[model samples]
Target: MARGSLVPETAAHAATTVARATGHRAQVDVTSDGAALAALGRTPLLLRVTAFSMFVFPSSMVIKDIGAAGTVPMILSCLLFVFWLASWIWRLHDPVRVRHPGRMAGVFFVLGIIVSYTALYGGWTGDATVTGLAAADRWLILAFASLGLILVAAESVKTMADAMQLLRWLLAGAFFCGVVGLIQFTLRVNPMEWVQLAMPGFTYNGGDTPFQARGNLVRVAGSTFHSIEFGVVSAMLLPLSIWRALYDQRGQRWFHWLQTALLVFAVAATVSRSGTLASVVAIAVLLPFLPRIARQRTIAALPFVIIALFVAVPGFVGTITDALGADTSDPSIATRVNNYPRVARMIDAKPWFGVGPGNYTVQNAQEILDNQYLNTIVSMGIVGLICVFIYLVLPGVAALHSARHAAFPALRCLAGASAAGLAVAAVCSVTFDSLSFPTFALSYPLLVGLSGAIWIMVKNEGSSPAPATTTPQTTRMD
Candidate 1:
């Protein structure tokens, strides 16, 4: 009987020992897992570089010298090259889906440009002047480089959280530039002179006017080369700012509302008719995506809001009317309008490959076409036009698809905003030669990539299995 009692006691002790061992192992695992998770929370160095690079890209080239303007993207390309090399060496697996039909179309577009470049310019001899086809050819190279860098950024984003981080950086940069533009407009100051003073080699075209004063009003170009570019950036941000103001209730909602107001004011100060129209279109596109209550309220308040705007701002309607009237009588407008037939003739002559990439300036006798569609057909022919269109349009289509199908309200809203921005870009391209300006050219493509990233995340989240639930227990010895 005593022996039986000893055996039972020993058995209980053994069980206790086993339970203690299991608990220790679990504690170690939890600690190690937590450390690993913390490590994972840190962003990659390459991604950080890319994000930083993109943030400064739009505003960095105050000095128009090749060495100065090209430095940012050149550095970015080197960093991205390093990342690419490391990925190959380490066999790293990227979680983001980099392959899309739109991106592929962009590749073909680049190829089309290359073919045109070869056929027209006889390849880069590095001795060409910075006028006509040579200048366009150089920009073509820059475009390809910019596109690659953007792709790297798009691929680096693994989740919506990652995308938001990148987006915040981008928005912050754009806003900073906008503020600079506001200063230029309000103070009648040009920051370019200061920039030139700071950078000895930087040269400003004496003829270029960043602050074109019209009576009491001024056209502000911000940190960019032109007012149109500034307007484009403002228009692009309008939809995003509106979305954040309306829906993003995470924290500091007032800040977003403030951003929206500032963006609207900035667009107005630009006095760009296309920019204003683009903002209107951007706001309109979000109507269907808004909740029923919000949509109805907004619609009801819109007329009153319009009345208040016209009442509050002196010469508000006149600003728009001036732009419209100027379009009819402005020599620049007349020149651009007259170029359409010339462009049509150019296309008819070289219908297949056109005049070559970036050859329009030379062909058009240095007159700006003011239309990207006409410019593309004149420069790159029908094939190039198709490729460019696909590259620009497909991402918008994907965003629209995600907007329609996404279960998450945030993602859906973002997708809608992206679609709206793209629509605005397309329409505005008619008034501006979009590809000529880095602010307009680089931004639209990056936004497209962002939409793609969001769509992928939404798709992945939808397909992921639900987490299994397990009940907690007071003791492990059950």
Candidate 2:
């Protein structure tokens, strides 16, 4: 009789009711198909492919002789893009209606890169290492691939279960990285060497080993291209691991907590100033939103963790402290400081749209600007820099908005975790050329897309009609 008054007793009746309310039988059928798909209990194809490409293989590995363009994740992203495009073209009805702000921002950011590249087309000088066209093409491929990931992930994740699964995959990947890093640190050996031997056609582009040294202490990169990248990635994922540890079911709690510990140890293994700072930033952003019990537990564990780190790694705490306190005399600090004047001149030449993406090579510029924000300015100009901020920061903002309004505690925790992860990425961008690295470049967009999906779920939950009072209620994951 009245809307939201009918209590369907059969599958047929439920479908009929849904069809009447939506005025589309096809929508009901699509819902049934989606349910059938979910019943299979397999990870969504895009999510699986992404996790495998990004985490299973070392980020430093590429197809033999293909260079940056041949990274496994990039190749998988391109394939996923084609699949998404074909699906979009073939779907005649019941298309996804969610319009996420993060998705819109990603589109604009990609467009800004294209605009900059078009403006500088053939006028750029060829460096001794890479041609201008080649550099631009490489960057464009990366930009497009990133956008493809954002779109696919946002569209594919249709429910809370999908979101949870995505997080699980990410956590699994981070755990793998952490374990590999700990091994590298303890054994003073690169495990990727064994991995390379096992795999054919994938070669390491990262150089002799995944180890770097500060004085006598050794730094480990795990599966990432550099120790700094490894540190930043661990810092970003730490919040998610902590969220799982605190909120996941009791049976899985121990495993998640172990994952959290591994990530902390991995970060310490890197001995990176930015990584340590990024970890602190993640914790600061995440702690305020966690429940009282979680917050208390985290605070209480801090002293023990610090004591363990001291005993386990010996000089780690002092190394991080000294690095943070280092003055301009420090080589890294001096390099960053000295680049400002040169970067200003470069920005002055073409303030609106600079030389072009990937054109600012160390070969031509004579120095590497570790700051991604500065790199964005030099390569894509002020407009591109603004776009970069929007693309990176908007998802976290959206995640926070969802967390504030979400009906379920689990959803809220997830939202907070996503926000914290993105915050780490945002803060770390200033400390390194984060996007230039394959691991972060791929991981960041996937997280953004997942956050957009979380936002959509919150919005959909808010818009749906309430259930009838007479019906027996069961808990919903969302």
Candidate 3:
């Protein structure tokens, strides 16, 4: 019996036969188990995160009625706290096998302290700190905590299998979100409001009621949150879909094409400038890595564009031009430019440490903090900035290294490209306001998984173990 990239059933049975002859029945079964888990374990973590309830439960039609508006996300955060608690308990039982590697968690703890302390200190200078404990602050921070919880659990406690399972679920939920977004796009409604009325604390925001925004057609964002959130949802799916298009399970080629087309339509229909642009840019960046046929298919798409334009005549082309040219005019770009000098002057008042968590948004007058970098600097101070640096830069570097050198060379192309693409988008986010969207909380974990998977796969080249097989493959999502 020979081992191939794919372990056919017959190959496994032959190995089992060999094991039986060797008087190793149990060992054969263990080998089979390891093989099965290995294939599954190779999927990327971002795909698994789709199954995360924080990503899923809110999208159903019954969100607000179920009392889930902020509640669902909140509970998801609590689940993180629970996960951490369990890790601590598990460590108590098996200290060696389950070392509390809070290596990642320690990074976050330092960040939280820096940001919180800076935010508080910024408040002390009283240049522009505004003080208040509001629901928005609580909800957003709760979401940030969820990211910390995921990394902490992933690094110190979770096995490769646990990571794989998470990606599976993340993909599953993302599929449903695509479905729900499709439904809303087709029907022009918010399903989360009506679908699961029994679930509490959920509120549906991903909808439009024939509403016009600034004279353009207002689109429904669906279960993801807002119009921008809809964009983020589409953005997350873009990479995974591209991954499947380039390298998928053997028989499902056409099926994956349909999935890709469906995502494109769903994203286009959302009519979100930022979301649409982000989705397009992200996928376009991935196009170079796609298979020749897939790449050609995208290139050949131009005729459809011309035909759609032909059908539209003047009405179609004009609307698209208008929509594309839609007013992103920063009414506030000028405001930020004017205000930041004063704000920076104020920040010079106390640049060492920031005000603390929630302080820039809370203590400062509402004007000082729309951008994440500016907000972070004003709130956390120099120490806070350094903490954020570790959180973002380290994982990004890890992912880049792995994506670049994956053992399954074809897998290397897109995983590396996607990691790089995400880094570009993340850096852009520092100056842009879109990071405030759900994608930030939703995506950081996926990035972590990619980084970890790439690193694991590269490190395990030629090794026939569970981590070697699963790390790269785990990236394949629902």
Candidate 4:
């Protein structure tokens, strides 16, 4: 009896010892994982670099020797793509484990561009200074770089903190552009001129003037290539600013609200119908998902905001109204309408792949299409246009899906905001060749990447076990 009792006690002691050892090991593992994530949280370095290149430098600024291809954002994007490829090849740890549909669509879109370009390799003819082959190569480079930005941006977000940091940087960029627009609109001065004076080896190629007039209102381009581009980008970013203002726990909320107001004013300063439409679309998309109080507040503020715009920029409201109500005979409206038959004819020739990408220059076509949808069809044909549609539409859909499934309210708000921004991009694409403008082109891809990042986070959170502690958890456990 004594021997049996001793045996049971020894067994119990060994079991307790093993349990304690396992718990200690787990604690160490969690700590190490937390450390790794914390490290990741600090490495939104690529995002910051990309944002700075996109927003801080004048969109018109290009390398003195390299022209359009030498723009800082373009160069950075290419480098980023190389880095992304190297990381993948080396099997670096990526927080986003799942293959997001948006990312896949982007890849397929790039492939489609290559295929289209390859199919028409030797038979292309165009009136542009750049040869068909050279133009196709440039377009392919841009496509790869854009895809690189999306991939890197999507992979950069390892935690909610990283996501917030990215949003904050984007908001800051928008705020900077807003302030520049305000200065240009009110003071009739281009801050980029001053920027140029302060720095040499950069040339501004936007246009003869940074400020233009629409009726009695001064139109501001800010740092973008055109006032329309500036306005559209501001409108697209407005939803994220609103989200930050409403839900962000970091810093003073009033500051974010101020940013939101600045973005709205910037959009109005452009006196662009497309910008106005984009802003309205974004707000409409966001309104349904907002909290009741927030929705009510937005509704209540509309009249006051309109009044303020009218008061501050005297002819702003009327200018937008007039532009929207402009007749089909209006030059811009007529140009877009006239391009349809031309584009349709061009599409009929190749239909499947059309002419190679970037071959549909103004010199060849006799006029710019101005509509990205039509432009894609003319340049890349039906397959490329389908890819473009999927690339543009899937991110927003995925983001909304993430919002619906997100466990955290903040994540849901972010997803909703991203979706709203993407909606603006899609709606604005029809009004202008958004991809032709540096600011909108870069900004759109960033939004796509961010939406993808949000989708990954939401999915990761939903599928993984509850974190042991709030200090950043890894998706996997050993």
All models: lDDT? 0.59, 0.72, 0.48, 0.71
lDDT of 4 by residue, 366-455 (tens): 388778888888888888889888877788788778777865545666778888999888888888888878778777888888787777
In model 2, where do residues sit more than 4 Å from their true spots? 1-43, 92-96, 122-130, 207-209, 363-366, 464-478
TM-score against truth, every candidate: 0.77, 0.85, 0.67, 0.84
Q: Tens digit of lDDT per residue, candidate 2, span 319-383? A: 88888899999888988998899999999987877778888867533378999999999988988
Arranged by TM-score, best first: 2, 4, 1, 3
Ranking by lDDT: 2, 4, 1, 3
C-alpha RMSD by candidate, in order: 14.5, 8.8, 10.1, 12.8
Return the lDDT, model 4, position 131.
71
Which candidate comes out best when scored by TM-score? Answer: 2
Model 3, span 157-185: residue lDDT tens? 12233333444455556566666776665
Candidate with top lDDT is 2
lDDT of 2 at 436: 86
- For every model shown, the clashing-pair count is 0, 0, 61, 0
**Model 1, range 50-77, lDDT digits (tens) per residue?**
4434434433443465533354434454
Off by over 4 Å in 3: 1-52, 59-70, 92-144, 147-149, 152-165, 201-215, 245-255, 284-339, 342-346, 361-370, 417-421, 462-478
Whole-model lDDT, candidate 4?
0.71
> Judged by lDDT against the true structure, how good is candidate 3?
0.48
Clashing pairs in 2: none
